[model samples]
Target: MNASRLTDHTGYWMRMVSNAVSQEFARKVAGQDVTVAEWSFMRALYDLEPVPPSVLAEKMGMTKGAISKLAERLLAKGLVVRTENKDDKRAHSLSLTNEGRDKIPVLAALADENDAEFFDTLTREEHETLNRILKILAERRGLDATPVD
Candidate 1:
């Protein structure tokens, strides 16, 4: 029987580039003492200051349990703080600590560097076109979730 080679698929090619890009970024963030998921969570929380984990979970398209887990990790690292709701003893909200707020730009810079490492080979026009195509694909596919993995 004849078989199609793996490299004949566009997904295979995309994955080859994606895995290398992702692995390098993972290494970059590891040096900053945060996982990619944590970075994503922190970046989300940065925008929704003092928000409940439930809200964060919704915004991130993540489970509440997942949000809680990320919150726990961030809290342990002193990068986030959880505050009890005044009206409800069992309810709480999460927010970035001063240190975490400070780290956002630094982490963002690392993300920029990572993108450059992988995509700088593309001409500026090519890069913009690639971004437009990816965005269109993402929108059409309803792939709206924040990419944590």
Candidate 2:
């Protein structure tokens, strides 16, 4: 019987790099009083406003409960507003407040900085190749969840 070492797997290397990148970005975003999960949630709302939480959950590939928890946090932070759906009194739609809209650019800048800091060492072709490969794998595996963790 033969067993392969962990280092023999490409997945090991990918995970190592991914974990480092995510951890660093987590630390950077923490300074803005938001977790990476919250950042993902807010980013989703940056474009599609006045959407129901169920729609958000589907877009983010997260559970409705998770969206609710994140919504509560953003609501408390004055970053989002929940309004009743006029057509359906039992339903509510969530939208980013002015403060939330203002903070998106700032948070996006942080994301840009984080990516540059992590992947800037690669050449342009290498960067593109890496992204292409990741996208292919994601599509093949049907992994659509935003990397909130």
RMSD of each candidate relative to the true structure: 1.0, 1.0
TM-score for each of the candidates: 0.96, 0.96
Candidate 2 lDDT for residue 61: 94
Q: Count clashing residue pairs per candidate.
A: 0, 0
**Which residue ranges in model 2 land beyond 4 Å of their true spot?**
none
How well is each residue in 1-149 modelled by candidate 2, as lDDT tens digits?
Answer: 99999999999999999999999999998999988898899999988998999999999999999999999999999999999988989999999999988889988999999999999999999999999999999999999988788
List model 1 lDDT by residue over 3-23, tens digit each: 999999988997898889888
What is the C-alpha local distance difference test score of candidate 1?
0.94
Q: In candidate 1, residue 144 scores what lDDT? A: 77
Q: What does candidate 2 score on TM?
A: 0.96
Candidate 1 C-alpha error for residue 50, in Å: 0.8
- Displacement of residue 110 (Cα, Å) in model 2 is 0.7
